[model samples]
Target chain A: MDLQVAIDRVTLDKAIDLAKQLDTQVDVIEFGTSLIKDYGLEQIHAQLPKLQHAKLLLDLKTIDEGEYEFDKGFATGDILTAMGAASADTLTKVYALSQSRGKQLFIDMMEITADKTAQIVNHPAAIYGIHHAKDSKAGFDAAATVAAFHEDYPMVQHISVAGGIDLTMAQKLATQGIAESVIVGSAIVKTADPVAAAQKFMEVMHK
Target chain B: MDLQVAIDRVTLDKAIDLAKQLDTQVDVIEFGTSLIKDYGLEQIHAQLPKLQHAKLLLDLKTIDEGEYEFDKGFATGDILTAMGAASADTLTKVYALSQSRGKQLFIDMMEITADKTAQIVNHPAAIYGIHHAKDSKAGFDAAATVAAFHEDYPMVQHISVAGGIDLTMAQKLATQGIAESVIVGSAIVKTADPVAAAQKFMEVMHK
Candidate 1:
């Protein structure tokens, strides 16, 4: 399983420093939506040097104007995200664009129902991200959620799970082996030593 | 009725120039989602001298992390937007934050159903923005949509409409007296004289 580290709610300089430190430690480095909205993509793109190992994913969470956002987003990020709650037309356009550009598209399945998920699950190349909303007060069992999702939509090829993910949950997900990747935000990025925290996560996932 | 001139997919320089010119001509000046994604809020806030007359609305299109986005967004904008499709928790937090700060919140009702709308329509102070997704190829009748929305949700007091709005539609919406504001994008901003185009919209809306 791949480890995706999400960096959010920090200054651009700190985000860049964190990304550089974790570049070799993780499979994917996510510049969360807060970073994008706070710093803007132009500044982020101008300042970001290409990573030698990790793929860059910008959590654009694009709900509309998929083509425009994806086009610009692909310039800096290897993968970009759109909201699963967005229109089918929007998802289709972004998916097509991503395929054309040989990039990846992550569909953020936050606040979407199973019925809506069925409608959008046909995109085999797209990664379906399952996570609880940051604002939701509900408890989340990442492994259980992944298991249920896989059972419901067995056809979904690539699955990613997030939301308060820690080392234990990461190992559980790795053992379950249903999720292609696990997204760790504060667990890794907000730690005393992000690089060491990421290395620890890597050790557990691979153990 | 109010006229909101949506400045999108343009350079930051041109957007600022157009906003300054239309500050007195229009009721609101919108920095569209494209601009936010392209230039970012930090750059936009740094370069923008506050508008002397018109209110500035940043289309943050926030789906989660409501408090954080609203906190940062309210610094440079009098109004910031959140997705109606987001979880109720997100909507509640952002609405509360907006109220506490004495700022405004616009809920983007793009692609939401009446059932979901019923759940989120309780925020009386919030502006319920009705529009079609930019990616959808289907035609949109802005006045009719607003009229239907108003009929369906009489409790929703403040209404705003967008998507392919022109002079005729603006006049119709104004005459209907249902929508509090009509948002005009390319029709006003793409013309040879954005100020004149905005003036034309203002005349029709106020006529």
Candidate 2:
């Protein structure tokens, strides 16, 4: 029942301020893909040094050039995510690289068909992330989505869920006890008091 | 055939210098994905203005948030690329956006399967880029690869190829008459005289 707060679509200074504020409070602090593409990985890496408690996950969403992106991502943070819809070869190679480096890989299961998921369920150590695209117009019951994913791929031990998640929904997920991490982006980061909002989420998640 | 000189893995100053030298010489001056990630797109756009003769193609390799990435990419240049391995929905949205903006789309068919290729060949206006991963341990034969891709998807009109393409392979691909553009990266950019290397490639590709 860990909380991952994602900061995105903001200026580099604001993103750094938020990262510094929430570093020791949250279980994982994600510098969202927009931040990475907007500010570049090197800039983020230079601004945010080694974390004291929380893991730093850079949402790279790499679809190709796994080795180069993974190497660069690992230099800055502890975990990186790749699209599940990428070629199985690329996914497998990235997983091997992550395992070898003693880092973690979060497989973003966004827009992937069931068949594609079946093809890539062999990576035991990798975290299978169930996500609904922010732009997706379709309705998603996050808890139900996680349940279905766990049933479909029982072998995947670690799972993460994200997309439009609020504190109540996060508590529901935590009570379900299947998802290893609950990712809340705008719901927590966009509030007037992000730190207080994050604390509220932590309270509900641990209750 | 057109020569798209990809300037990658070089410092921004060096890339700007080379682009200035080859601005009017090549058919397309590509700011590669490495440069895009090394420096933000805004900086890249500000640093490298439009080419005098050639179109500027920024290889965003966008896999998700198609609208946001395309909006940002097309703001800076006339052409952008999306991963063919991306969902058909993403590709379609990006293609429509590019068409509306009077720009171009280059679909990077790097690690996609044949079935996926068939599903994505409907975008006639998009250039189907045949690229081999630089980090691939297996050998790459660019000209031969284009011949096979053309045979498989004969309906795809605009074809582009990039790998470790040399002057000889560029000439061979030119004679083959399948690919509309040949992308050469390190072979030209890393050379002592990048403009001279580009001129040699243009010569070989024309003949």
Candidate 3:
């Protein structure tokens, strides 16, 4: 499993610094939704060149106006996300745009039911992100969730799981060999040493 | 009924200029999702002082991490929006935050089922936004949709409707007396004379 270190709720400068430091250690570097809404895409685009090694994923969390957000988002990042709850038309348009541009679309399956997920899972090129809402009081079992998701939708190839991921969970998910990537947010970015935290997660995943 | 003129897909300068001109004419001035993503909130916050009249609504369309997005959004906007499709915990956090600050939260009800709406529509102070996805090719009858929504969820006190609202549709919605506000986007902003177009819609709604 690839380690996708998410940078969130920090100043853009700090986020950039962390991204640069963690680029070589992780497979993908994510600028969370907080950075996008707090800082804006134009400014984020200007500062995107700071990272040289890792792929950049901007959590746009686009629900509507898919073409417009994707068009602007692709200018900076390698991957952009759209909410799975968005209408089929929105998903279809964004998926087409991402494919045409040779970029990737990550479909955020947050707060969506299995019935809805079945309708939108046909996009083979898009990454189906199994996101746990940050505000949920319930505990998340990342490995179990991925296993269930994989069982439910055997056709889904590119699966990414996120929310409250720790080193143990990362290793478990790696062993399961189902998820394409695991997204770590505060576990890496909020620690005293983000680079070290990321390397630790990377080491566990690879081992 | 209140009229909300949405400023979208325009340069920040033009949006500010239009907001300044329409501030006195409309009940609310909205910085659409496009503007927020394009310019960033800090930059938009810097320019928000120009509006001398009308409440500002930032369409944050927040799907997760409610508290963080709401805290930042409420800095400049009188009202901020969260996706109705968001987890109950997220909606709850944002709703409480908006209430604590005495700001308003608009829940964007896009692509959500009536069952889900039943779960999240208890916040009386929160405006339940009846939105049509921009990507959908289906025709939208704003007045009819609002009437049906009101009938289905009679407990939902505050209702706001958007999507291709024209002069006739605005007049119909105003007469229907179900919606608290009507949101107009390209119809008003894309016209050659945005100010005059806004005035015309205002006149129709009042009449």
Question: lDDT (0-100) at residue B162 of candidate 2?
Answer: 85
**Cα misplacement distance, residue B178 of candidate 2 (Å):** 2.2
Which candidate achieves the best DockQ against the true structure?
3
TM-score of 1: 0.96
Residues A1-207 of candidate 2: C-alpha lDDT, one tens digit per residue? 889999887888898889888987899999887777766777787888678888999888888778888988899879899989788988999999999999999999876677888999999999888884444445557887889889988999999998888877888899999999999988878889888999999999998
Best candidate (score: lDDT): 1
The CAPRI-style docking tier of model 1 reads high
- Return the interface RMSD of the candidates, in order shown, one decimal each: 0.7, 1.9, 0.6
lDDT of model 3 at position A102:
95
For model 2 the local lDDT of residue B205 reads 81
The residue-by-residue lDDT of candidate 2 on B7-33, one tens digit each, is: 876787888888899997899999877
Off by over 4 Å in 1: A132-140, B132-140
Writing each residue's lDDT as its tens digit, candidate 1 over B1-207 gives 988989999999999999999999999999999999898899899999999999999999999999999999998999999999999889999999999999999999887777788999999899999883344445547766887888889999999988888798889888989999888889998999988998898888887
User: TM-scores across all candidates?
Assistant: 0.96, 0.90, 0.95
Spell out the clash pairs found in candidate 2. none
TM-score of chain B of 3: 0.94
Q: Residue-wise lDDT of candidate 3 within A1-207, one digit each (tens)?
A: 888988899999998888888989899999989899989999998876656788999999999999999999999999999999999989999999999999999999988988899999999999999964344445547777888899999999999998788899899999999999999989988889988888899888998
Q: Top model by TM-score, which number?
A: 1
DockQ of 1: 0.85
